[model samples]
Target: MKMKTAVLMAAVLAGGAACFAAGAAELAKVENWPRWRGPQDNGSTEAGRYPVKWSGTENVLWKAELPGKGCSTPIVWEQRIYVTAPVAGQDALLAFDWAGKALWQTTVGAEKPGKHRNGSGCNPSPTTDGVSLFATFKSGNLAAFDFTGKVLWRTNLVEKYGRDTLYWDYGISPVLTEKFVVVTMMHQGESWLAAWDKRTGALGWKVARNYKTPVENDHSYATPIVVRQAGAEVLLVWGAEHVTAHAAATGEVLWSVGDFNPGGQKNWVAVSSPVLAADVLVVPYGRGARLHGVKLGGSGDVTATHRLWKREDTGTFVPTPAAYKGKVYLVRDRGEVECLDPVSGKTEWTGQLPKSGANYYSSPAIADGKVYAAREDGVVFVARVEGKFEVLSENNMGERVIAAPVPVGNRLLLRGERTLFCIAAQ
Candidate 1:
């Protein structure tokens, strides 16, 4: 059966490679963010010189009010920015131009809001390949749109597959590779990872992920990221007390590390995605600050030998850590940021956020020699990435901020509770 599955996946990948080659080529030449974690899937951008300070009315280039609430970060491609929201009982996608003017808004599906406190219908961010935009919602509706807001293809995963049994809302953004749009749905019931053809909404491959973890630990709100290992791109999926690396061309498991929940804690639900720095994959186990670094390359069950380092003091619950310049920065839930050396897992420096008692759900964005960390109370603390953790600026939006800040060109795009602000140099 395993041999048959491998042979089928290889045939599917070979058939779709030619169809998506042009789109993949266009994606490589585009400088804008095409996915959830910027160009490289690590929350870092090459565009430098963002504004050092900004507020509700100060240093703000343009501010436009969104129709409803969402936690998904805005993605930029070429001259437009795309974001998803739940507006008037419908899951909608809103587009804005580089000037901050609202261009178009298209309703994708009926809103199926989650029952959790921080849950929303439109939690997953969209992905693009310089041609069309792909978005998924908590409604299980995944759709594709052109640059002018015209719907190309649409499908509902819950209706075709099974209903998502997630505790909170579905927040995993769609991952776009060379030939496939991969989506992972892992929850209490039947969990699976599936891939679809990027142009046509046809299913390419689906694989069931079986695990023996506790019920609560069976959920994952994290997104999948691609990493290059041994001359091949591998998709990294984290959930159910394990970090598994799958072949990007096909949904075959390459390697997995299952020691993330050694104590068998049931409530250690994974919220943060794994951040890859070169060949080392950093996996963060929720609630305990338990982090493990696994060296890439190897076959199945490499947990014992490939595990390089483990640390318990630097674990984070909500926000995903950012890696830049050979250092990893972790933002704790209660407004503390710590920088760790990727090699030895040693703390370089620890700094406190501007506002105390404020929770940070947004991941940190590292670029232009600074780290931008947003607090739940709408204050974005910008600190220098160099010598002694010096705070460069603290800009408050005066509204709740849940989405991570995105840096494009020379501006910082900040999505608050009800407004999107473009901060540039005055």
Candidate 2:
């Protein structure tokens, strides 16, 4: 599928400006998931009251069969669901209806495939701006497709931008802004964060991360989150060796901090992206387990003066910490769920999950006074978010879930190992 070059400039509105559906109402009210984590990149949802408990046979509104396997989270806009998959030698972009029916599946492109584990296809999640859906693959192929599976425009990041050398594969999901779609191409030789025209897939500009050590595929897979810092919007990126900021519009490096780990380590991987709450930035790095919070201030190069409160040995390399209220909630790889004060980096409360294993890849989704977590053992646990963790409900889908669940309206859209289910209150 090839997209036409018709780049347009229109401000994408939040979900609140729409009509009311019985379960999910406005766009912000619960429709557009947009990116990996929900709106605002915070995991917390403006979605209506979703159910606290659901099983395979209970409260399952519908179950749809996917075309192929993928770890990419499902993105929704209006009444359509978009997902990406690679079939045979071609990458397929499939669109499904609200009732769990396949609408159209189109072949986007085919290229040299990257290595992924446990049937995990490309980790790129599709991003929509309420009008168009933007997607990227492990092969460094990025494209913009319409609501239906029609391609709009495409670009080969490896050919145009340079080669992608990320260790595992390209897992960073793209984010859409008012004028451009931002992508993180953290690779060797050409390690940078760039912005492209949202209407047409044209390069606007790129800010390079001039690293002392040669660029490694081990740079970062962490997605960029747009934050309002010091009265202006800044894109925050955290990965292998550094945490930095860039102008969202022009791809200019606003500030940076490097040498996060003194002795360069290969096992060290930054899978979790940066989480922002107000002026404070909660950046987590692991395999060694360290989570830090830096307050944003100053102009170009704020690494020396802006380094603030850091919490060590408190996070997993996979689960990105979600910040709400004044605390940050996290789920370790072994299923240790805890809440910590973002400022002090101190644990407020910790709980040993019922289903514990080393295969936990899903992140904690907070909504309506509860934290929803899904594990590899086919379990979904709900705990009360009251500083002290309280297990309220334990639900299961009887399938492995690697991708995080997307909260839309009052329903929870979960993509398991073999099925895509919509669970909501009956």
Candidate 3:
């Protein structure tokens, strides 16, 4: 009778495990843009269709005028949309509902206004893990809030660490991993990468990320990315003349690639973040004609051997590359778009996007077999991700746009200079 009871208990536990696995799989299919670069952190989404054509009035579902200006992209989770703005001399994180109603706005820290021409205090994008939202500002403040707008915890990195000395304002967006909110603070003075507990805002680990580069070249506005390799997850931090991978659990430097800024140009700042495609990781350097493709699963400096390929004359200056469906899409600062093979770094196609009197700071968003590249002067050129460089539509938002468009479900969220416009099918 005792043996029979043990068998029945084992069967019950097995059934419970199966149910939990199924629930996790179902949750992954919910389609939520929860972070700086969407769910995958590569500026691409599987949410499928998004409206290709939108004007100032046509196909725009709703437009909410923000209090002040921001260049960070809006992130969405379930029915809530969160964005950061510098309003009334404060760095504020605003929340909105699905129907474009303002839910709540909370002041996170004092605004350290950008000194550069196109920079802002709220340049870093906020990231969410569905339960809590994390935001960072140029003031070096990091805050966390629950989905219902309750402030859970807040801390200022500048208070703990030293002052940031970047040429422009700090713009590296926070990355939320399963266990921590990882942040890379690379600048001219006392650079480091630190991770904090997402729930309690406690420091989990910190590592000094000093790089032996020129003063101006030490500044990096690129964000860190998380990638999975060999059944283990690794966090990648790009900038400071190298691309370093850290162990996601302990903040240990696993490997690095340093040939990106070989000649040590004083003005070579890393603006674009690394994008991972399958087993290859593409790292872009500013003012360079080539981008490096490093193969994953290495221990030390893999610059000599692990490099799969390098594409000359094909690097982006400001916009980060997007990888989708085995192809990497790059939008240059001067309105040029190139699609290259991820493994070999071979150019598949290249063409110029529609000019809007300015350059591009926003990265390309790939969804529904289309690549959406937004220009600084408020024009978004939607092109097909197929044979040839065919443009499907040219969308004009009629305002200065610097943030990448967020695609969720059948709608696209575009944050311009003063308004957040939601575009959907008419």
Candidate 4:
């Protein structure tokens, strides 16, 4: 009788765990890059001694050839790496071990190829909580998988809700809290912030997040951020000419900050996501024309009260700013770099990379006092950004790269158009 019950449990675990709802015991550590924006959601990590000089062949620990091109950055936990890419003609999730060996591949739904030259069907990066992984695609496929590559649950948001009407590919990656995995949609019609059960894939709640703005300002490809305020978790979402906060559990609107476009600027769509530097949230808007700094806590409309400062002289359009050691760093779209004081929104120092005809699509990343910025044309520049800004070295990957550089535990992962290269001092 005991043996029969044990066998039944094993069979059920291999398929799905909705009834069990139990996950692995290991929690995410400081060395893990659990999500696309990195573990802290600011595109910087201090746990690794990253390489400042390396070529395609030098310091290349290992390279795993991906099945197809994906603009999403790879997330790492411990020795495992997870990435979302289209396999053959279907959207798929792939797993790889520490030694660049492919472990498994699981396909979820049909692929809807991207419209832009760098876009793809699997543009959103896969996120993990050190137990199960989650991914969303442009085709509206939302699926969860256990560590062993078993399909836990799957659904299509486009089929259930409606198709996305964004001008570019769907790029906002999913974010996770302790109890739920939340997704934000800020397109032209019926924008919302919805949460789903991390284990069962069930909808928990959805709250409307509509606002009035100029043309194309309603559409947002920026991911929502989880923050702590007054001993509770809040979601910081940016779109439609405002930055709003909502209760993570109930999806209730907490507060909002507006007046970003006083001139009613047209076609000033949001591309880069915001980053948190200590208590300040740095937002880049107006297609590289402006930057604003807002405080973290408030209720109702706090546009006038919570705003720290605003800058119109410099900002980024595609590359999100990276926060390191309480300072917000901007590797602007045209390779001009600026380090700002988050508290005052003042520029601390300024520098520039080698001027490139191609803009920067991959956001800058910092690890161990070094900065890594990649251009769309495949050249990556490393710089020392601590006291005096100094250019480190330039590396050419010889392929298009849109994914941000991920550094964790002495290894730097660069996802290019042809392969995923792991860099370390081996």
Candidate 5:
């Protein structure tokens, strides 16, 4: 199951360029979901006219049955949709046409089954820079591919840096910057943030990000968010009970904030990632019960200086909060939805969806002021978060969903347990 130094990527191609995909002139105007958090690195896509009501049979433009189980969210560039899945027990990346047809399938290597019931070997979503795309598996294998589904290069992190010590499966996806594709490893031991050359797969930089925390608190499933501050790229990482900012170019720790667990709580691993609302950074901690708001920028040890506001009553455990129009929208695991002012940490409004025994692991997404959320039992809900919180619709997909709902141009994409569905306004 080990990938050789010079990786072997075999792609089975189909329809080319996903024909009639992106209009040539409008291509520059189109808002493609290049990464998991979307084009803006937040869950909101202000350009799309997503479906407000949809079901397994209704409003579905096309539905493609997936070849294997995957929880990774699909990323779209133009009309080409890229997702990771295990095809015949091998870790592979699959491409689909805009018409919901398989474009190509490329095998990376053997799959690493998840330890959690809802986990998978393809938890990390694929990221693309329009020209080339990047994907990483739980096996620590990261590979890059061309838009035609040809493997450009491959590298195995676990093979180079040794195995991860996280309690559960790796959940962080690869993030693309101007010149590098960066990834992070946050665990009880040997935590680090590293970047590699986007074109040649060469090691660009690696920075140690280890921290001490209570037992099991060091294990983090949260994904790092990339943002720009002071006109330069910076990475906001949440893990090991600390929030740190790193120089995206040289992998240098510019500033750090800690003391998240003041009471020394144990087993409070970070799963829900940090989200940025304007210039304020919102972090969910206290195992989904507490939330924090911090002001962006400053030098080393901004723990006391950048601290803004915090909430002790409510937070989310699994679903990363989404920010739109400078407000934070959080869909708690148990169905409680809260919209807050990111700068002041003030609760603007709160609402709840239909009570379900199942929880929400998919991060909520916002499109044109509407919040799209998915429950584990396959029920997707749309809530309007403008003047007040209002439940718009609860559509059932008839399967499980752990990936975040993605709203691309003129359509909303939902990746179910065994299928990929595209919903459009009709």
Candidate 6:
């Protein structure tokens, strides 16, 4: 008991120092990919002179080995990269250096294995505020840790809210706002969207969920996105069967669109996070697998009022679609790529990838003008997307690529089957 208390105190002090250090806005390296889809989550890599052509043999920076299986995306801050893994009977959180050296590995909690197909385990991606990293464990634990593997604080969402009653494992990554850290635990009876004090882990506001689906898959792997409009901030949440807009300052539900479709028994579901650009929320929804684009800034069932356009066939449930400029690109699970105009939802072009029989659960990354798509069979498709499909280069890593490749300037940080490789051209 004394040892636990001492460790807890040490963690608290370390957490305070990390939090009060400074805001990441001024010191955040624009070149490092900090989150799932970069800062804006539009899959945009704005760094000048990004890698256009590279393979496992060429322009290789380094590769670090991980212990277990996890589909969590890698996030970078400064000189470190963080990833979560579920190995043996423990869920481990690992930090690696820029040179692919192992820095620290902290095991968070005992694993509570659940039903998950397709080699996906503990799918929650890690999020960082440039100083401290926040991750979710399969045992229903949400923890924050410092750079040197010192745990700061942990909150078991299952103990607080209740156990996870979902079919697949939890996959929702925590999103950090200015004042709070927002998370979603969408269970059956006590489902809610809650925010905690970013500094102290105090519960801020938790709103009871009103939306429920008939399926036992009442779990959302989509992370929350923050959008500021009209001088007000709103957190966009897409869960099991509903997409909701909430007040960031409070836990009030501003608007929601329910009646979600999650495919079928042998069907795919919408696990991709939503994208926002030009004040318009581009969500690829529907269970039978259709995509919809809705304009924001409305109240109460805005589906009829703010829906810009609805596109079918080209949309995907797992791969989060990408929107840039006036166009949106959708990568289906079967390795098919389609580019559409976001304004009209019209398909610009569609093409099949070279690697046949490859499944694409990783989202496409758009850097400069090139699009990067990593397939499940370990092939990275590099193509030029301007008006038509032009394959630039196809890089094969020879391992299963499950997590999305994070674009950090000219370097692409890719986490493969058992190793994380940094691909950058000289």
How far off is residue 101 in model 4, in Å? 0.2
| Per-residue accuracy of model 6 over 1-426 as CA lDDT, tens digit each | 011000000000000010112235523543666667778777776565567676645677667667876667788888678888776678778887656677788877887654543344456777887767788766777777888888888788777777766545566777887777788876556778888877687888988775545554355556778888677888888765667888888978787765445344322234667777666666765532677776777777776577787666656767777766667777777767888767677788887667576567777888777788887677888887876778888788877776777877456778775777777666
Per-residue lDDT of model 5, residues 1-426, tens digit only: 121111000000000112234456644555689888888777887785778997645788778888787788889887788898888988888988777778799998888877666777788889988779899998888999998878999988889999888666788888888899999888878889999999999999998888888887887877787888989999988889888898999999999888889999887778888888868889998767999998878999989989898889988777888888878888887889988889889898889988877877788889978999888888999988888788999999888888888988777889886888888766
Evaluated against the true structure, the overall lDDT of model 3 is 0.77
Task: Give the runs in model 6 whose Cα sits over 4 Å from its true position.
Answer: 1-30, 52-56, 216-219, 259-268
- lDDT per residue for candidate 4 within 1-426, as digits (tens), equals 011010000000001101111124311332788888887888898775778777756887778888887788889876788998889989999998766778899999999987767677777888998889999888989899999889999989899889887777888888988778888888888988889999999999988888887888887877878988888899999888899998888999899999999999787777788999978999998878899999988789999999999999989877888999999999977789999999999999999998866877788899889899987778889999998899989999878788888988677888886588877765
> Which whole-number lDDT from 0 to 100 does residue 93 have in model 1?
87
Query: Weakest 10 consecutive residues, lDDT, candidate 1?
Result: 6-15
Ten-residue region with minimum lDDT total, candidate 4: 6-15
Candidate 1: pairs in clash: 289-315
Instruction: Give each model a TM-score.
Output: 0.90, 0.87, 0.90, 0.92, 0.93, 0.86
Model 5, which residues run further than 4 Å from truth?
1-30
Kindly report the root-mean-square deviation of model 4 from the true structure over all alpha carbons: 10.6
Across 69-96, the per-residue lDDT of candidate 2 in tens digits comes to 5667787787788887766667777787
Query: Model 1, residue 87: what's the lDDT?
Result: 77
Tell me how far the alpha carbon of residue 193 in candidate 1 is from the true structure, in angstroms, after superposition. 0.6
lDDT of 1 by residue, 1-426 (tens): 011010000000000011112244433443587777788777887556777887655677778788887778889998688998877988888898766777898887798875543546777888898878999988889998998898888899988987887656678889988788889988887888998888998889999887888757888877888877777878889889888889988789999888777777667777887777756777778563788887877899988988889997777777888888777888877777888877677788899777575667778898887888887778898988767777888887888777888987777888876788878775
Better of 2 and 4 by TM-score: 4
TM-score of 4: 0.92
Give the lDDT of residue 197 in candidate 3. 96
Quote model 2's TM-score: 0.87
Write the number of the candidate with greater TM-score, choosing between 1 and 2. Answer: 1
Estimate candidate 6's alpha-carbon lDDT, on a 0 to 1 scale: 0.68
